[model samples]
Target: MESKSKKQKMSALEQLKKFTVVVADTGDFEAMKLYKPTDATTNPSLMLSAAKLERYHYLIKEAVEHANKVATTTDEKITEAVDLLSVLFGREILNIVPGRVSTEIDARLSFDVDKSVKKALKIINLYEERGINKDRILIKLAATWEGIQAAKILEQKHNVHCNLTLMFSMVQAVACAEAGVTLISPFVGRILDWHVANTKASYDSTNDPGVISVSNIYNYYKKFNYNTVVMGASFRNIGEVKALAGCDLLTISPSLLEELENDTETITQKLNESEAKQTNIDKINIDESTFRWMLNEDAMATEKLSEGIRKFAADMVKLEVVVEDFIQILGK
Candidate 1:
């Protein structure tokens, strides 16, 4: 019994959970049950992938039936089906994770603040209809200028929480903080991808541009006393995950979560308020024009943001096709 106890050790993932709230970044419920993340985040791409699975086809059928009952035109039915499907997935995930589920607004609405806000309200209403409280949901927006503004209105006016995603720079992060956003998902792997593709250089976790971006944002938020949660997202590897051991939250993919669970490496806190307070970082207030100008100035950020939006939008289109096909089958 002494030898067995001596052999026991906490995995790197367990160590990470001590300092950071680990969020599962996949649509797979099985993965969520295994890793047991405090939160789960989903996007059009992930939903598109999950909707293709046979086990989840029931969800698609249910969504289609709900749409047929509520909507008039074919386009309207498709839209309703998509929205209902997202909430259905969120509802299912909420049952498993025991925390909030982030159901994203349509990426096509990323540039339209009014539409985004309306859709968010619609999503929240869907959740509420199923006895899920609004507090249990985080409406995900694209972190565009319009998205940030929508979040500001939702948070201040409607009492809705938001998670700003596709963020790649301090300009976006600072703007989000100023807007009193509930959370901001600064993507790490995508930033590293842009730098590597542009400069043709390799990077490790310590000096990774993505890691540096999140660390800087985390420090800035802490130093300035922002209440917004910094959730480091889109990690490419466990090394990047380990580097951000002390982030407020880290939404990791299942593959990386598996890696962390299998390895028993000791990790230390890399971010803390005490260290952040000691840093010589200056705070900058970002208004609309300055936000636009700053984002325009950062080539990598601009490119990546546009690319991320387009990819998500394209996947949303693909999801529409899937819904349309399923609707046809039902008609047959």
Candidate 2:
């Protein structure tokens, strides 16, 4: 009996869960119900994909009607409606998962700190009105300079937790930690995407840029005693996901989640607080200039950050168009 129990405990998914929080990266509430992740994250792209499914079409209608009740102008109505839609999807995912839901603001607002803060607060209010606790939400922002700045204020003053996303550089991670944000999502797959495109080379998990990116951030945070959680995002394959087994959190796609569940290979811990503390690294201050300079020096980070923002912004526009068409059909 004891030997059987020990063998069962050796499953990769179970062992990985022992140290890190698992978050589902999609907006699909039904799938989340099955996988039972500790948290869920949604961006415009994910929400748009979910809204297209006939099962979730009602959420789109509900958001439009909900927005029309508050705003007067056509533009205002569309804007408010999109915000409501983001919250509505988040609310549904929250119901399935036992933990917080991270809903992103518009990617176009990534550079406008003030606008991002206002948008984040409004989303919080929308969720609150729906009877969800504030603590059960994280307003995901881009890891741009402005976005990081806005998150600091939102965390310090408004008591709103922030997840700095689209992070591809160590400098960005350092800045986010300094800002005292709730979490930082270092995109592992996107980092891999950039390297593959430029070098046209394949990499195993050991040397994968994506895996190395998250690992560096994770080690740095632990070494410096930062409270910000590091969540590895945008994994391209099971190897990329498995490489980051001991990350603070890893938001994975539903497809990848299934891979983890089926695999019984032993998952070993590669990172821990004690291990991080023993490694010596220089802690440096990153003001705006240093942050910008460091990012410029790294080609992968520079290209990937811009590319990520553009892709998300494009998806945001597409989602708005969908909402616009839906509203036009309503003839309001």
Candidate 3:
């Protein structure tokens, strides 16, 4: 006979798949296993945090040893170290999750289309050499105009899949779809953060700018039959997650995943194409000049985009320092 606790405990994975693809947006492999998310995502910030934990010590040590053995220069060592760390995390994540894992390129290269594409391909190759198939990896890059263009070439020419990150507007989403990228991660919490600071008032999910942005993107993709998957990311609260109940995917944090798991309340569908057709939303095609001008005009978008990049870049540097310190301790 099943215990009351076992009977009452609902699976977050089951509820998550009904509305959106469940993605574990963390670098902690043990936590990821407990939730059993379908997919997983990692940024420099999450990796830095994970490396600080005692449980992930071996990953840093191994990365340093690998770096010392094969790298010809300091720059090469850093690159090799980052690649090794990314693969270590990816391998650990694959053990827990059944779907793909997103490993990001350096944020500092977001504006350099060619460099971003090359780096992405490098990371994918590293994973491949380890016997991990390409299908289970999504190269995560920032959604700069150049980044999208790079993704276009990578998809059409190289046959590599991508997940465009730090996306905020319709223009970016439209460009990604046209580029034939595999997925786009529209940040829900970050958008809400912009709205709250600008409006100076608390916002509700139904009418929240962030919630509406993702809903619009999801509907647009579905309406036009774009195969690009829209995975809503950077969630601040459960309300934002609930608001985007029907997104193609939602990469949520473990805390919110826990909340959803504990509650047994009914969840409802929010956004769909059938409803989208009823609303009047004009589709706009964007060129490089227009895209830049539009981004320049929107202070919130411009500021948030730059801020996100800097934060991620800083985290990457910090992670490198941690790796170096770990190497010294390991004598490699």
Candidate 4:
């Protein structure tokens, strides 16, 4: 009776946490505190949303002041301010979560390897100045060819960790693992969005294209003995989150986390290394040309990756404008 009562008392969230690391996928500190995710991830869009809130205004002010003190030109100030703001949020998140935080590089720098590497290093430097170590930070970059290369340099040459975002296809995963990147966040919901829009069909959790993509990537990584962490991101529904329950990690929004917490039903492990290793699969080495060609061949991956970059880049510009407004007010 006691064991049965204890089992019944466990929420699905607690049960799921037993198998996988639950990462809060929002910039909301309150949500992060409530969910107590092991790690946290932030992007331009999430940061932009958080910046508009009154509670985060002080962070913006500090970032602007830091930028003004260091940078002479308006362009330099905006860049510095945005980077500082990202680090500031990351710092606060680190205080709440015991694990690391994934702070993004400027999305516009996604295609330029040199610029991306420089920006990543700058972000890491900013965090270090705040007394945060390199090990507790994961610099997020888009999974473009150049972004992967930049991550390679940061990981191998500089010993900085990286989380490659905007991932959709197997090619991106293979390339990231091959580059010795630290982690990869495959946007599960976005892939499902692409398939649903094209096919005009509804999918259950089991048959979700996004879930399948992550599962396949997980199996492949386990099969090949790749150490790159697979953290599923951008979930659209609780069903999708439930489907990828046993992923290495799942970065879920606060809403889904709440739902999982409220539901008392126990969930099953959907992915495990033992079962993954037994799956029959072939491995393909992804070179620069092969990666591009394969990515181009998959219309879904091609369109989604481009769209994700463009959207994040657009939000980055909007974030800069927010910083500019702060700069004007603070300068006055």
Best by TM-score: 1
lDDT-superior candidate, 2 or 3: 2
TM-score of each: 0.98, 0.95, 0.94, 0.97
Ten consecutive residues with minimal summed lDDT in candidate 2? 6-15
Worst 10 residues of 1 by lDDT: 2-11
What C-alpha root-mean-square deviation, in Å, does candidate 2 show against the real structure?
A: 2.4
lDDT of 2 by residue, 65-92 (tens): 9777888887887898899999889888
Alpha-carbon lDDT, every model: 0.95, 0.89, 0.86, 0.94
Instruction: Tell me which residue pairs clash in candidate 4.
Output: none
- Model 4 scores worst on lDDT over the 10 consecutive residues at 2-11
Cα lDDT of model 1 by residue, 1-332, tens digit: 96565359888989999999999999999999999999999999999999999999999999999999998888998999999999999999999997889999999999999999999999999999999999999999999999999999999999999999999999999999999999999999999999999999999998999999999999999999999989999999999999998999999999999999988879999999899988999888789999999999999999999999999999999999999888889968
Better of 2 and 4 by lDDT: 4
Clashing pairs in 2: none
The local distance difference test score of model 1 is: 0.95
Q: Which sections of candidate 2 miss by over 4 Å?
A: 1-11
Please give the TM-score that candidate 3 achieves against the real structure. 0.94
Q: Rank the candidates by lDDT, best first.
A: 1, 4, 2, 3
Better of 2 and 3 by TM-score: 2
lDDT of 4 at 146: 97
- Alpha-carbon shift of residue 93 in model 2 (angstroms): 1.0
Task: Give candidate 1 regions above 4 Å deviation.
Answer: 1-7
Task: Compute the lDDT of residue 280 as modeled in candidate 2.
Answer: 79
